[model samples]
Target: MSANIILFHSVLGLREHERHLAGKLGAAGHAVSLPDLYAGVATDDLEQGFAIKARIGWEVICQRARDALASTPGDTVLAGISMGAGVVASVWALRPLTAKVLLLHGLATVPANIRPGLPVQLHVADTDPFFPEPDVRAWQHAAEAAQTDVRIFRYPNSGHYFSDPALPDYNDTAAALLWQRVLAFLD
Candidate 1:
């Protein structure tokens, strides 16, 4: 059940939490590529994180992910957090052979070329300020239209970055549950 996975970091940049998640996945026997889309800068401040994210942009992040995927196996599962989820949604169309997609804290539009029954798992807060209802619905509709086997888990009353321990928004219960379900998905 081992897999080759490329996990993209969130706008906060690549930090210990991401590496912790990668360790969890690796412990489960999956080979992981935890890429730092921000190169090396990571912050705990929300405003600074946003500024950094805007500077790096999604296109640049997608290119970095694409370059990482180019060297991995064809069926490498693509996983990401927040902004990273958007990266998966952006490039998955170019990787039709991807084994699956795992998203955290955000949702992305299903590309036109995605095949039916492609497995996708998403974990997010019930109502994330960063992820609006309209966008979530749109992404859901697109996934359904494409017939992707999509599973969405919503953490009730949780904060946007509920899974990050370093963030004030962290919820222990939500984070544990997320990992439980994510591990199941990985299996």
Candidate 2:
């Protein structure tokens, strides 16, 4: 199957959240790949989750992304949530892969070295403890400065990682709306 869109998951790896998204994108006619970054090591506890991800090593995580990219066919649209988003951003920086970006649950600081006029979308929780409003606004300015078409949607009063229904942080309404925007952006 030919895929034009691929989404990598957070350090949590290929869970329902990522799989569900892949199904939606596949239904939208984009071959989507949700690679397993964690490689079977996962946790429900937030601190443990962070620790497991850290243990995996950034370079390994990055190379896993590379492997996923190499496996996917056609011109691809890169998308990810949380740490996955960070991975894509890292890849975009080092390799400059030519694809639109759809970032969910996190924002990657667009380096001063990178300029953007291309399409980019970000879906975030308005009250995300990890990414405060001030930080997101600053990111927006930087993205805009690079000419990136940055569209950031905020889920007010929602917890971080709102898209993952299995997580306590999930918000149904916010997740649904985020899906709608993601569909439109990928289209």
Identify the candidate with maximal TM-score: 1
How well is each residue in 120-178 modelled by candidate 1, as lDDT tens digits?
99898987998877777778888888999999888987999999989989999999999
> What would the TM-scores of all predictions be?
0.95, 0.90
Candidate 2 per-residue lDDT, tens place, 1-187, comes to 4347767777676677677778878888877777888886765567877788788888898888888788665357778788878987776765355467888888876755554566889999999998899999998888999888889899987998888888999899999899888887777
Query: What global local distance difference test value does model 1 have?
Result: 0.88
lDDT of 2 at 53: 77
* Clashes per candidate, residues 3 or more apart or on different chains: 0, 4
What local lDDT does model 1 show for residue 53? Answer: 82
Candidate 1 regions with alpha-carbon error over 4 angstroms: none
- lDDT of model 2 at residue 177? 92
Judging by lDDT against the true structure, name the best candidate: 1
